[model samples]
Target: MTLGFVMLVHTAFDRAEQVARHWAAAGCPVVIHVDGKVTRKVFRGFRDRFAGDPLIRFSRRVRVEWGTWSLVAATQVATERLLQTFPDVRHVYLASGSCMPLRPIPELCAYLDANPDTDFIESVTTDEATWTIDGLEAERFTLRFPFSWRKRRKLFDRYTEVQRKLGVRRKIPEAVRPHLGSQWWCLTRTTLQAILTAPDRAEIDAYFSKVWIPDESYFQSLVRNHARRIESRSLTLSKFDVQGKPHIFYDDHLQLLERSDCFVARKIWPQANGLYDTFLAADRPSRRVAEPNPGKIDRVFSRANGRRAVGRPGLYNQGRFPRQGFENGITAARYNVFCGFDDLFDGFGAWLARRIGGRVHGRLFHPDGARFAGAERVFNGCLSDNPTLRDYRPEQFLTNLLWSTRSERQTFQYHPGDTPEVVDFIARDPNATICVITGAWAVPLHLSDLSFADMRAEAARLQRADAAMTATLQSAGTAARLHHWTLADFVAQPRDRMRGIMHEITGPGPRRVTDLPPMRDLTGFPAFLEQLRNDGMKPVVMGDFTATPGGRNGR
Candidate 1:
């Protein structure tokens, strides 16, 4: 028994010629089908290169387009010519111009000779097919696609929508169970003859001509009836991405392809010199005779598919800026936000950084500028502290900060005086750990050397902002870990709150908390609250301020 090959050539003429010569040298007959899109002069020149070999023949040309009947038509003409010209050939393998033979041709022939009667083609029913894209599975067989999805996409879509609206579905040909699979296959001569001469050949051809991407379905569906024995899997190794596009093998994929142990692999890069040279070497090292197992490299492709679909966490680029609610994650790592602690204590950021063993920044969203750690003008990833840039896209600013320093835990101060819109984003992020000391903003206002009227008005505005943020943090759908306390309540038992905050930040452990940071003096804070109330603005969320020492000793 002899094996024949029908290779569909479109692009990469040089590579195609090299592959054709390789196949001819292996004592196998090759039939080449060059796309009509190539100029006649170029086609003649390519054909003339193989003029010396009698085993190599060129078939009639056809203009092939993606997702159209032309590809299938091209294949049909090539296969018919090969079968008619090669009298002793019993099996025909279909491959593309970009395909490369991975194993020795003798090994492939021996494998085929063992199963001369079985057809190696993927044939899965439409209901069982999960690889179809754009919501067209069974609809592909029923709908008439007269326009090209590649060149005339808008018209094609409009026509499809019109048909859907008008409920116009083409009737499937009788006795034909529509199936889908990869366009590549290896079929026995008997099965090919049977399908070509079937009584309903004209009807099947006409029906499939209007089906979308008919090349993937025409032979696959027809083989179900004519093939005496079907393995239902292609011998060629091919993998597609999440977007339904084939993965091109590059020079880096040399080992990855070898691990598959398949006879052939498709869609190799034209410039991948390493793969072509290594795989096409005449005296290549012999591999063990084992069944083709593409599953060996399936895990690598699966990971690549996931990276293309979901993307890496906290990373955003032009190609994969996912739609809203589709982000893999909002931030790279967990970080802490101290809402009012900076105002109520001296050197709180430094003190907290020491306790939690993490970097801490003061008022990252402050109107003046982002107060990065150590007062640096620029921090990780060259992120500047310019107020305008940070405020332009506060959410991206925070995300970038967290992503750059993801190796260590981060803590930053936040206040009602900062960016108000960022509060909602923080509340929604599961990676945020927010600690709110409510009404502590009043301490800074009271300490400032401003008129009583100015202090009262500023206090009211800040209170409103903080109140809105508090509602967002305490909402039913909040995902961040929130720890809120009234100013008076926190000072009443400062030690316990500090200990609890440390535990939450560092996680549960038996670590002891001995020395606490000193708190700012609140010598006339109660009177200050009374003054604000008397001036027509009530001090709410403060929880009854009183003159008392609640720092370090909690007394």
Candidate 2:
């Protein structure tokens, strides 16, 4: 049986009519949930353009609020509309107006048909874990970005002005430490209906209203609880950071976006006509395949029936140490560095430890082992102050590294994934920056103490990318200027010299963080080295970090 399709959009775009036609041709139904706040002119524009397109169904307008429940509300309303309008719809996909389908329509249809039971959503649960957030620009959002005169609305104008003159952040409550996630999902009709018509619908709706990003987490959590047979992955393919936030679009990212074979690409600038047009032109006659090819990480969807355990680090990494969140303010503080990815970040943590004292924090991981060790430690120690994600995003990791360097405190990255892409990423950075090292001799546990030789060699390339990314902030004109400590010209530096590096990064005598937890965990200080200590084992230097209870046998 052919699966039904519904493409939901929150805004009006030039390509919607054309995209709708392709859906009609594929014998699928399209449901568009436009922002209720848009003007009537925009509504008529979409209606006229999509008129007579059988697959396209214009839903009642939904109001979308910024930094609030509006996104989830709009999605819920859209799902309800899609379900009510086309009850037989097999898989209702929530997408955006700017998204361009990469696979042939038939290919997408066939893939969905093959996997009917799988609810394709990146179902993540941070339940009582340390999270990390890359609000390196968290302060910026509290402020405001300058928009052109056209977007200078009287209401937002005051908001922006206040954001600039006096910083105002989104109200994050004390009791609720929420983890944000990807908003896109492709759910079965049964699952969708169950969520909309749940017996405790009011509670479900109200409970998520307080979530940081209800749109991303609500349905994801709902389905995971209700439906057992799930791929636990999202159909949408966009790179996210350690914070679990989606990657923003940049010029260098243009090629990367094209290679990402997922059905839709998003979070595009609302008015980047050239980029949007380029995306539409990637495939004209509609390339909407169901099953993604096994070629690239950009497009290839993992069919693994299971997921990395969300709250299982407690079982692996001693009793649950304090959870690190992605949102931890990366201000100038004494950040304890935790390096991960044995091959990727082994040595850099040691260098950082030398700066703040040789403290390496890590979690005992299985299968998807030391690949993201750095991220896990960062997450574990992050607590209530960060976004959390399982993926090893270089930007998020690097940004936090920059923050720690400025703070003059210790930070950690365990052995994170050692992909060439990450190496290329590091090579593109400058010496003023910090990262865990990668090499053949690096032990997974000593991810921090590996070697900086590769990073040092690639310093020039990384510096260039660092310079380029830096230019983005300036060109876009941000008030909060971000700085990086390029770790270059290593030969000239004094041996075992980070105080010099610290002074170079943050001018003037180092000021100890006036406020840090008085009671700190003992797992990090390479001196305390009591991480896995159990039996009376001979603690040598190399084995000190890995000495579980039963010496090497305990592991």
C-alpha lDDT score of every prediction, in listed order: 0.89, 0.48
The residue-level lDDT of candidate 1 at 253 comes to 95
Model 1 agreement with the true structure over 323-398: per-residue lDDT tens digits: 7579888888999999889888888887888788778998999999999999999999789999999999899899
Worst 10 residues of 1 by lDDT: 546-555
Candidate 2 local lDDT, 140-219, one digit each (tens): 21233333223445754665667667645555333223333557778888888877887777866665564444565567
Q: After superposition, how far is residue 322 of candidate 1 from its true place, in Å?
A: 2.3
Misplaced by over 4 Å in model 2 are: 1-12, 128-132, 135-180, 240-255, 268-555
Backbone clashes in candidate 2 total 107
Where does candidate 2 have its weakest 10-residue lDDT segment? 300-309
TM-score of 1: 0.93
